[model samples]
Target: MRRTTFIESYGATCKNWTWSWSFVNKTQRFVIFGAWQEDSHHIAGRHLILDEHWATRIPKGSTKARRQPGYPQAIEHLSRVAEEGYALFTFPIWQASVGKTGAGRDPSSIGRFEPRLTPKTLVHEGGMWWAQDLSVVALHSEPDVQDDLADVGAPELGRDEGHSKPTGPGHYFPRDRKVREDVLKKSGEKCERKGCSEQLRYKSFLDVHHILGIAKSDRVTNCVALCPNCHRDAHYSPNKDALNKQLHAYARKRPSN
Candidate 1:
């Protein structure tokens, strides 16, 4: 993507005119920019760094060093993006200077990546939560389990005691693109609503609605393809519960093809 386009896109999602290390757009897709300072900082693995506001060296839970201004929001963003199986786009910058117009830009390695959720250490610690061990895998590939672990260092299991396993239910339910694509395909590129007559238009795609909740499963049985309008109705309409029931019933009746 062009620098101008990147700035405009990031600016729309973020208040700051300047681009930060990472920002998730309205659609929950993550835009991560690689930095020279992060490389110089020896941050261990190939991780998506966050803004400096979250880089407090003071350990987490320290009364003296409270959470930074954006720390809580950063953590929430990480959770939602990961849970929803959002795509993360990376742009590598060569120099430490953000002002340079054409910083050492690497084009070959630019690609969409998914976070390898199997990090041995907890994602949140020391007032930070960043995705570590990213691999350029196919978007439709299976969830988690990085294909390339040859270069990734083993989890520093004992390094940070405070970091614990991600707890609670529904922690890591990444939506499967394969299932979503299948649902869209089964819908024949048209909105699956009973009476709606929406067709897929140029440069437009249907949104896959999870009738049974994305946290439960990304299986085709639990999903339906709907246009933006119908999708909104499924979530926001006063009779959404009934609509969801109908969608789920339709999904079950459709062939697996």
Candidate 2:
């Protein structure tokens, strides 16, 4: 067999390093290795994952710590990397939040070592592209266990401790800007209402319509991308019942995770 050596090749030079020199200097695409903190700073192993706390320390790639442009390209690249059974190496950066507005960018992890295709929530309403579960290649000293990720399954969208429930179920704002954008991105920004072709606009004009009614369910599987006219028809038009049924069937028929 032809032994692969990308990871092995970097072994000699991989060390406790900063992003400016290590990450930015590479002429080719690179993986985030690992990161350090103010007090405890050291590279441990080759494929070991760092604790969740280290995520925030990943380097910034954009101004004001905004969503970096390299994220989508990274996702496309890392998805292949994961399938090829390789992990990414890099520092983390800030990910701006976007929900119902459907106006922001797809969230990707900025830290070293992305999970080729990280696990996503299937049953949950939001198709959240989680950032913290990725592995760090600098923590483990054993032989390669990177292939262990092949069987990884969908996990719950676990809420961190001290999470505040401002009101009872579904009392939050309706224009959920962040979740909507994720749905649109997942849907490829095309109108999900069967054969409808949404007229392109300068910015996104398609409403992330709730097929099952927001009062009933605001989950991802219950949402659909629709033009403004189709959006109104899904609600107040005389044929709304039939239109809504079509959307529901479409939403459930497609896979979310």
Candidate 2, superposed: residue stretches over 4 Å from native:
1-175
What would the TM-scores of all predictions be? 0.35, 0.32
Clash totals for all candidate models: 0, 33
TM-score of 2: 0.32
lDDT of each: 0.47, 0.39
Native-to-model Cα distance after best TM-score fit, residue 17 in candidate 2, in Å: 69
Residues 104-128 of candidate 2 have per-residue lDDT tens digits of 2222332223222222111111322
Q: Model 1, 1-257: lDDT tens per residue?
A: 45545545554244332323344566545544343224543254434344334433343344454333343444444544433334444444444234332222221122333231132111233333334434322111121211111112222332123134334321332345577678768989889989995997732346677675442455788777777667667755788779888888888999753
Candidate 1 Cα misplacement greater than 4 A, ranges: 1-174
For residue 209, model 2's alpha carbon misses the true position, in angstroms, by: 0.8
Worst 10 residues of 2 by lDDT: 138-147
- Collision pairs in model 1: none
Error of 1 at 15 (Å): 42
